[model samples]
Target: MTNEKVDVVIVGAGASGSVYASVLAKAGKKVVLLESGPDWQLTDLISSEIWGRRVKPAGAPILLEGKNPMAYAAQGGWGVGGAALHYYANFPRLLPTDFRMKSEHGRGHDWPIAYEDVAPFYDKVAREIGVSGDARAEEKWRPAGEAYPMPPMKTFRNGNIWLKAFEASGIPMVPAPVGMNSVEFKGRPACLYDGWCHVGCPIGALANPQVTYLGEARKAGAEVRAWSTVTRVLTNPAGTRVTGVEYYDDKHQKQTQEASVVLLAAWSAQNPRLLLNSATDKHPKGLGNASGLVGHFMMSHHVASTWAMFDEDVQNHMGTIAVQYMSYERYPKKSHDGAFGSSFVTAGFAVKTTDLANSRADLYGPELADYMKRAARNLAGIKTFGEEQPNVENRVELASEKDEFGMPLGRLIHSFDSDAVALWNANFEEGLNVARASGAKEAWSARGTMPTSHLLGGTIMGTSAANSVVNSYGQSHELPNLWVAGPGIFPTEGASNPTFTIFALSQRGAERMASQWGTLTN
Candidate 1:
């Protein structure tokens, strides 16, 4: 049977897809957004950590095989907001140097577009999303942009302690620009700073797509189909364009939804996996694999933390579960002594009693309880983040085994280079110094066990189709109507948090599609 057609079909209801849906719907285009997970509401957001586990994608587990295997589910969100539901809302712009990775640094791939191209969108998204920060504090490292709409969130005692420590070490610590409501901008309430951002925010204080763009799209008459897993992008006879998508509905029945244009915003790992799985006889490798780089260069940032046992009670759980202060002293390659690349440092991290107890393997029962009690009152820490240079060997290829949906699962293969290891080690020492300066009686550093949520560069964008999957507009090189959004399109993994960049890129992509599709005038 012939399927219902729309002006645009966006796969994934996360930040990028939701933003695209909102823009198109407001521009008077008919839009249908398909999500692999269920639709979530404000009330559905539970404050408990146990309940937060249910918010991640579990439809089918992604198979990981690498020296540093990514915790795919931990980094991905399942419901309407996608992974943004669990994100801490730390939004920072990529510097001008990030776009010219190869030309300037002779490492990583250069972006098809420049910082100037995406800067306006960054300002637009920051205002729309209600970021709270002192832009003047970030002026040294921040790209040219408008000041934040809201003042930076109040620094807690923990932040004050860390800031002094950072300052003593000659490290420049500035207020973190986070996409969180400091004083109720755009009808959203101010953040209470309950310190549960790693879970889900129930009050709409943080700018999850469910409360921001997706909410606007719903009001603008965009249709969102949750629990709808898109299986393939159906191509035209010439294999020159996408006609629609085939997906399994909530009821487990297969259905087709036709559209003039199709956008994939599923996520980094999944976006490339979907394209690779849609290989047809006409395009044996994959629809967009003519360049043979669809799933190559999959990269995630490396994070390591230094824990301190302080003499005073800093109350680490009192404020937002975000980086309150940051130092970009080593962000430029020329600024650091060791390593080919550089890293940034964040002030402090949120902690819980159970999480601390579980870390010490030697303690159990009463001993665990005693240690947790002492740790809760005296423990504090700072985390350092490093950039990952894209490597061809680091990728997501389809596994031989298929999931229940008749699609091949992705087998991720990733490894950090010597430069990356050196970068992490260099920053790790700096973090310990900062912790010790915070008046810690003892300080220890450890490598992060799991992968952070910053996933980038699977179907990366570049000037040449020979080196990339999409153009700067996020449109597939081979198929004009097929677009890919989200962090997966990043040509190089910048040192800053990626949510803001992703938002800006998606807005630019949607505007480009609108201009080309002639839907804005329609």
Candidate 2:
């Protein structure tokens, strides 16, 4: 059934959509954000790992088929706040080189805009939401920007173990730039450091959208329609512009939201899935697939995780469940002889049901129990992140299988190229060395490629429709009224987590969208 038309209908209430909802509403545009999951309020954020799974995608899972399948459900969000509700709040910025990957290295795709274009929004958003970091100490890794509003976040007991190794390896590390408060800012409390970040942070210190942008959106008169699953982006007869969207209500009834502007702001897979599923007689391939590249070039960071055991109690469970120390010595895309991409250091991972059991794949009976007993006090680990090249063959396509709503499920096909493999291998060996240098009585790592989450590509933003679905500002090239956002628009997957960049890009586009209200609606 048709609903009353509004100025804008944004799909997804996650990181990117929340930013748009917040800014556009403040700019006086009538905004409605549709989420496919329940309306998760702060009180709904339970502090239990098992209950925390509720925040993950509860509907149909993305069908994965590739050399290394992604951990989509583990990383994706289902409810109101989206994945931001359960993310660890690790807020590292994309290196300036990230934007110009192809321009500088003759590999990957160059962003239509540069890091400079995103810097202002990054600075503004970080301050507004409360980011804690030591930019000066991050050295050449961090680009020019205002210092973080808060200082570095809390450190765990295992931090010393990794710090010593970092020093010895000549890859000195500093406190990570994090979204959780180092001290109270914007009235949000400091992190409890209980390491319950895997579950949702109920105290409102972690900068999840519920505690930040969505709150702003509500105060600014934006309406968040939770349990509204957007299935297709409706286009005008000529497919020149998007008229609105078609979705399923919580009761599984069909509903339509007509808006002057329609945005596919969900994460990578869902955005392209919606678009490809919305094909019309005028645009047979997809609404934004005039170039036939709507869901191509899907990318995920190449990651490898390593763990170790210190002689005595290291108390690895006491701090933020995020990467505690940061180093970018290997951050240059071609820093090494054989490696073709950049890699970074992520150490002192929170030990929750961890030193992580992946290393002991063979042990289960008493061996696993004994390891856990020691891990309670003396376990620590390190993980290394490397950029994954955006290969055309790695992509998301509509699978033959359909969900309960009769929508074609998205099937992903992805594999690391030789360049990404070389990069991951070089850094993975060093990660093992770093663990050994920590004076660990025992050190080991999980075999195979680690399950990754910070996803990118699929509906990449570029210079034109011939090569990309959206432009520099995330405006769709084929349909100007149709916009896309989040990590899905990234041309390259830099090693750092994507939430920080997602906010910055959405903020940048939101301002432009607000400024062009007359041009768009008219």
List, residue by residue over 276-385, the lDDT tens digit for candidate 1. Answer: 98988777898788999999998888876777777788777777877788877778875556686757778755666544664454578899888787788677777777
lDDT of candidate 2?
0.85
Give the alpha-carbon lDDT of every model.
Answer: 0.83, 0.85
Report how far residue 40 has shifted in candidate 2, in Å: 1.1
For each candidate, give its TM-score against the true structure: 0.96, 0.98
Clashing pairs in 2: none
Runs in model 1 deviating more than 4 A are: 358-367, 448-453, 519-522
Worst 10 residues of 1 by lDDT: 353-362
Task: List clashing residue pairs in candidate 1.
Answer: none
User: What are the per-residue Cα lDDT tens digits for candidate 2 across 1-522?
Assistant: 899999999999999999999999999889999999999887877877777778888887799888878778877888888889888788878888988888888888999888888888889998889888887887566666798899988777687678887788878788888888889888889988878876788888889999899999999999988888888999888768899999999889999999999988888989989999999999899888988888888888877777788888777778887767888777878776798887878877566673346556667989998877877788887878888989898888899999889999998887877887787778778888888888999887666655665778999998998888899889998788899989999998788888899999999999999998787876
